[model samples]
Target chain A: DARVTQTPRHKVTEMGQEVTMRCQPILGHNTVFWYRQTMMQGLELLAYFRNRAPLDDSGMPKDRFSAEMPDATLATLKIQPSEPRDSAVYFCASGPPADTQYFGPGTRLTVL
Target chain B: EDQVTQSPEALRLQEGESSSLNCSYTVSGLRGLFWYRQDPGKGPEFLFTLYSAGEEKEKERLKATLTKKESFLHITAPKPEDSATYLCAVQANNQGGKLIFGQGTELSVKP
Candidate 1:
């Protein structure tokens, strides 16, 4: 079955530590999306890329969070000096033509 | 401002029960509305997509209907496997296909 894949399904880091999450989108998808899920905010789109080009990162905190698609098959979301409040599940998704974003198993991050 | 809002933040039902969840949205130019089912600790699974008002789609026990300003996901005779957080998202035509998601409706079905 073709599915979006993510590594390091769970992580725990001290506050102010750097964390990197990886995703391998389904082959042939043209779009990638990064989202954060929390009890208060629900599922929030942090950033996305179209054809490996970032379309938006405005929702992401520039100082702490960054998303990139170095190639068609790989995408990454990195957080530097992560805070306790930043502890949440980060999800990566992919789609063709950017219509229906198919999500991978999320990476749960816990910052102390 | 573009937004999607889902109602009844949570619901609990017995097996074979039926119910409907609502999603209201306001977009500059509506490209499409999507529905998804998310299991705990897992990313969302795609359900349905509606592009026009009065549109409807179905699969198994789920059906989605769209209108001018809102959409509804109906679950009929639901099973335990149907329990999950149902999310609603809207795509703006001018916004390059980024999805604005709702807070989601958490559903639990008991045997």
Candidate 2:
């Protein structure tokens, strides 16, 4: 079965640390999306890429957060100077031309 | 501003009970409405997608119907394994593959 895979399923870091999360999309998918989920905000889209090029990152904190799809298979989301408020589960989803997306298990991050 | 809202933040049902979850949305132009099931400590899984008003889709024990302003996910004879948070999202015609999600309705089924 084709599924998205994420590395570093759990991460705990102190404030001002850098955290990087990686995702591997299913083969043959062209679109990738990044999302953050928390109890208060629910789920929010952070960024997305189509064909390895970013489509939007408006929801991400530009100064501290960055998302990039270096190639077709690998996508990464990085946070610099992380804060306790940034603690949340980050999810990566991939899809074909259709809008329906398949999500990965997600990376749970905790900042102290 | 485009927004999506789900009612009854949580729901509890007996093993054989049937119930429905509501998702209301307001957007400039509707493209599609999506339903996802999220388990504790896991990512949301795709359930169904409704394209327009009067559209309906079904899978196993769940049925989803969409109208102009809202959508409903109807569960029939839910099992304990069916317990999860049901999320509703909408894609606007103006946005390319971007989805606006609701807070979600947590469903608990007891055997």
Candidate 3:
């Protein structure tokens, strides 16, 4: 069965290093979203894209974080000079529309 | 601000026992309410979606019902496989698919 797929199910990086997470949305899904979950913050929406154009990213940190969809099949979330506070579970989700989202096995990032 | 809140941050139940978890929200308009089950290290698995008040949906031992301001996830005679963190989210029509998630209720079913 087709499902949203994310790479590097786990990641460990030194603080200040550049880290990138990748996601492949389910085939034919038009909307993709990026979310971060932590023990302190619960789940927070970082960004969302529709048909490859970002619709809302107000939840994202503009200074050190960036999200993009290079093409229909791929979406990426990157952090420059990552910090210890950035250590959290980053989830990638997709849906045909806005109501329901299908999440992928999240990428757990540990910044040391 | 639009928000979702779930109650009973955690719950423990014996196998074959039944219980209900709650999700309350404050949003300008409601598009849908969603229920998901998440394992410790995995992504959330979709369970049900309720679109309106008095609407109910079920699968296996899990049933979800929605009302004007809240939703409930009812587990009936649950099994070990039913142990998980149950999450509730709300979608608003103007929110463009953005979901407000509640603090999940961690459920444990022990035999």
Candidate closest to the true structure, highest DockQ: 1
Per-residue CA lDDT of model 3 for B1-111, tens digit only, reads: 889999899999999999999999998888989999999999998888888899999898888998898999999999988889999998898778998898899999999
lDDT of 1 at B20: 97
Worst 10 residues of 1 chain A by lDDT: A93-102
- Misplaced by over 4 Å in model 1 are none
Each prediction's TM-score versus the true structure:
0.97, 0.98, 0.99
lDDT of each: 0.93, 0.95, 0.93
lDDT of 2 by residue, A2-98 (tens): 9999989999999999999999999999999999999999999999999999999999999999999989999999999899999999999999754
- Name the 10 consecutive residues with the lowest summed lDDT in model 2 chain B: B91-100
Rank by DockQ, highest first: 1, 3, 2
Q: Model 3 over residues A30-56: C-alpha lDDT tens digits?
A: 999999999878889999999999999
* All-Cα superposition RMSD per candidate: 1.0, 0.9, 0.7
Weakest lDDT window of 10 consecutive positions for candidate 3 chain B: B94-103
Candidate 3: Cα lDDT at B78: 93
Residues A36-100, model 1: lDDT tens digits: 99998988989989889988999899999988888888999999989999999999999888478
Clashes of each: 0, 0, 0
User: Candidate 3 — which residues are off by over 4 angstroms?
Assistant: none
Off by over 4 Å in 2: none
